[model samples]
Target: MILEEKKKKDEKNEKLQTDLCECYLLLNMWISSELLSICVPCLLKAASKKEESEDTRKEVEMALLALCNLRFIKIEQELYLNEIKEIIQHHQEYHNLTRLAYQSAWRFLVSRLWDDNSLEKVIVVEQHFAREAARELEELSKSVDWKKNKKGGERKEKEEMITTLRWMQTLSFFFGNCYLWNEEYVELFSSIVGVLRASRDNYREISEKCIYPFEEASGRRVVKIGSLWQSGAVDVALEEIHKSAKDDEIAAKILKFFMNVSRRLKEKKKDEIEEMKRKELKRKIFEKMEEEGYEDVVTSFHKTFDFLSNKYFFDDALSLDIFDYLVNV
Candidate 1:
């Protein structure tokens, strides 16, 4: 009946997907500029194919591997770059493919970003990646295997977590370089704070991986009542500051977060309700920093890094004046 016919059709599709993967791998051994240019469009089509079955997933991975092996200059046009960005931005693809395949595709896309210094491209890619990374972060926090993997449980789950951390570093790079809109910051901030509070042993990893974006968001007017200060983002960050005080980088990032939060306190010309909200947020953050002994932490870094000097050798000192005018605000 119809069930038997559908099964036969699935079998045939699986076989064709497997054969195409084999052919793509074989062709990768003899990659050339002209051959790659001709093959890349088709490869992109395959790599972005919606994940319907295990066979289709493998075919997409193979196509990505083939694309990775090929020369970038041969197919670095807007069409191909957009195709690759679309692949990276597709949140469902993260769940469908193995960690290896997903990592390879992302690395390939980043390689292109580093080579091109176009601000427009960087901004566009950052927005897309930020949304996807936020979704992945929320998903990771809820995953059962992620909880087990934290306790040295499963190899595959551990690798997946590592991949997620690396992606966070990539996000930090984006936030450090470009400015994201308010909506993007709200979503990313909510997810990052949730993950940090939920984390157990990997606290430093979470702080180190996410500090830049947190810093970026704190510098902006991200004072949405429920998502920002009210959600305990500043509290979790201060708690981490005490927990990670021994690590200078994480501590410095936490101080920068406070500095940025304070900088927003100087904003003017807001409506009555908005001004009241900002005042309350500033009061809570300053109070928490005092309770957590942040002055000792900031003074410690200043003494070590010589933040008092007018002329310092490292530009990192310039960024971490710790007590400087919090921002342009």
Candidate 2:
């Protein structure tokens, strides 16, 4: 009887489901924090609806993306533990919802980590939240089909693995800086490294989002002992991506990764041994690029008219992602 009732409920709401909103528009437009303050609550209320039906679920998903887009503004308040719990319990509404949870966590945590008082607050709940995320991630990674469509009304569209990995990468940055890096679930880090290493086509995002955040989070030592890039997996992926990628988006991500790494090495201090190692790695990368005939990747990146005008020269419709990269890269 319960199963039938659940099915009927799901069926009734399925048709009311809406498509994911163009949250990217928030990225492409000029908006102020004051204006965002007005819109954020509406999105959150939509995200916080009581029902787990498809329509409500999509609303939550869209709101989360919109929140991530406006991440520049300091979050006015911390989310309740119950709401954070629902983010991990996203499987009840949809599959990719768990990933959206990671993004929300990233956006929320990052806003606070830079400030003294807010960082104090993060330290208080840091271990508890990290452990909860690890447990949920352990369950989610069990059947990670990056290409498969989500269940129910989302069957037509494949899972948004790229965005999900970006979120995880941001989470990794937070974890890298927190006590969790030194003392929490080692297995969870291993799983993330494994999945990221296995990725092929979307490796550009991995390089920019995943590896870069890990670098930012760690101070003296970049990645921990079992860190993904330390395993040489990131280098291998970059070689493959540089060799085969033709799309402008992929090129942009790759170029941005290279740009960022060069800048980090130049500005940061490191121990003698790690310094030698990084220089050697950089030399090898350039050598390989020359061999593969992608020596002109950056030159080509600069030459791309749309990106040049939109991002570099005009900087009008610039994205936050690109802004962050250019500042650090």
Candidate 3:
């Protein structure tokens, strides 16, 4: 009876999660379509729902508020510029949703002005909100135990970090495409780099046991890491029950240490030599994998490397698998 009850409870939780995810997806789609009035009501309902946690509710509220700002822009452009001025003159709601809302409003206003028009008003608005958002993100990033929380929390920290990185990369790509780099965007990029550095540290900690590094006969460094726990040294030793396992375990430990060093070195570099060395390291890794007959592993590694390389340099939409890869691997 207890087991049956537990199973039922698990099913109920799954159902609730699925429902919430569907609602969020619809909300995002509606926002993209400029149907903010429709999206806001649904999001507000979700935000007020008693079944969800505070975090989930807050997330929904933020989405609704963002949509409200977009709606204001759309309506102002289409119908009510004069009315919007009067509303802003009288109502705090027109002013205080979030920094993102304020920025969006400023952008909408600036985009309306002719080149001959002075940008003093719009520039003031933009500077105020951009600074506010930057301060908030910076404080939040600093205060959070990002590494530990990312490793142990119910929410997958690695995936969230990767998603955030990809979003920043996309923003940078768009800015470059439009020849519109600005100080505010540069600060955003710096914040992303900080987040990525934190995530890299977390990945190292969580996957410490699985990595191995060694110098091959060619004097090049080779890293042999397990993709999953069972495929590593522990399982091999289990199979070879008669052999002395101490030597193999020691070798694995040494290799793991070297692997960690290689990763850290690559992460810390800013010069051409370091870039060349990173490529050389990747080449050596594939060569070693091929020698070990791990062709599938080599293929997967190439695919991941290529995917990230494209994501870094191109203005393309990222795959959902990028999130899974970053968080899990």
Candidate 4:
């Protein structure tokens, strides 16, 4: 009886291994309608690391490879897109599993935008990818700290920004065609614009216009911020700033983006008395903030923006030398 049970268990293991092998083969050779019905379920099961063990990592890796290639398959169903989003957003073991999810996302994206042989459809199917790219980049921007780092933390902050910048520059290419498909492409531009304005390096000259989102999102936010100074329009960004404060690094990126925007406008419009004019502008902004239900945050943002924009305005140092004063006297 023991030997019989052992034999049955061996057979079951053999069957699972065979199915996993077949899943890879189907993924590579092309999953037919018949094979897809069988392969996808098995692959998804194998791809999961509920145990998250090193022993099971190989299975997860293979499953991800299968999914990466299978992302080549055209899945038009809304349900499938949501599933992919959940996988990409899954945070349980994101550090280990996200690499595959990210790769699969890229593959899923490029496959749709791949333009080599087929007759073009009137409406492109690029919304899912553009939205995902935008969301991911937005998350990064919100997560990064724009505050003055201490000596030891400066390198870490720069590394984080550079990594996010690289991702934005690469994904912006894939998001280009999404403009015609859906407005999700606009979200991509908004997110990337936030990064570009905050980044120390210039990516525009590198990627060119192929990666540029649009004038309305990039230039407006970095320069003027169309309606951000208004009471009604400030809520969305104020909320983002509040959330950033709750994170590991106390990010000030969203606020910095707006501050820079405000500074640029002030520079362009400074034609009259400096101090009185600056006080009026600051008063108006504070009143708008007070009316916008941001009492807790308003004070902090107000002080930070004031300090950054007027770094030299408080200087009391005189440049006159004693010898020069004697000569003049």
Q: How do the candidates rank by lDDT, highest first?
A: 1, 2, 4, 3
- Using all chains and alpha carbons, the TM-scores for the candidates as numbered come to 0.63, 0.48, 0.32, 0.36
How big is the positional error of residue 182 in model 2, measured in Å on the Cα after superposition? 5.0
After aligning candidate 2 to the native by TM-score, how far in Å is the CA of 262 from where it should be? 17
Candidate 4 RMSD computed on C-alpha atoms after optimal superposition onto the true structure: 16.7
| Candidate 4 Cα lDDT to native | 0.43
The model with the greatest lDDT is 1
Error of 3 at 59 (Å): 9.4
Clashes of each: 0, 1, 1, 0
- Rate residue 262 of model 2 by lDDT: 47
* Per-residue lDDT of model 1, residues 1-329, tens digit only: 22232247435454344345446545555555544454566667777887669888887877776665542343456547777767766734456665546655764554444445463344444535556567767876776242434355634435556656765665555554443344555576778777766654543465456665575556545334335566567767767766664435666566656666665576653599977776766666666677777667666666544433233233234444556623221
Model 4 misplaced stretches (Cα beyond 4 Å): 1-10, 14-38, 48-62, 71-132, 138-184, 194-329
Quantify all predictions' global Cα lDDT against the true fold. Answer: 0.57, 0.46, 0.35, 0.43
**Could you give me the TM-score of model 2 versus the true structure?**
0.48
- Per-residue lDDT, model 1, residue 35, is 47
lDDT of 4 by residue, 55-84 (tens): 565565566555556534654443134444
Q: For candidate 1, what is the TM-score?
A: 0.63
Error of 1 at 299 (Å): 3.2
For candidate 2, list the clashing residue pairs, or say none.
Answer: 260-329
lDDT of 3 by residue, 239-322 (tens): 222221223433333222333333433443478886776556555543543455443322344334444434333222323332
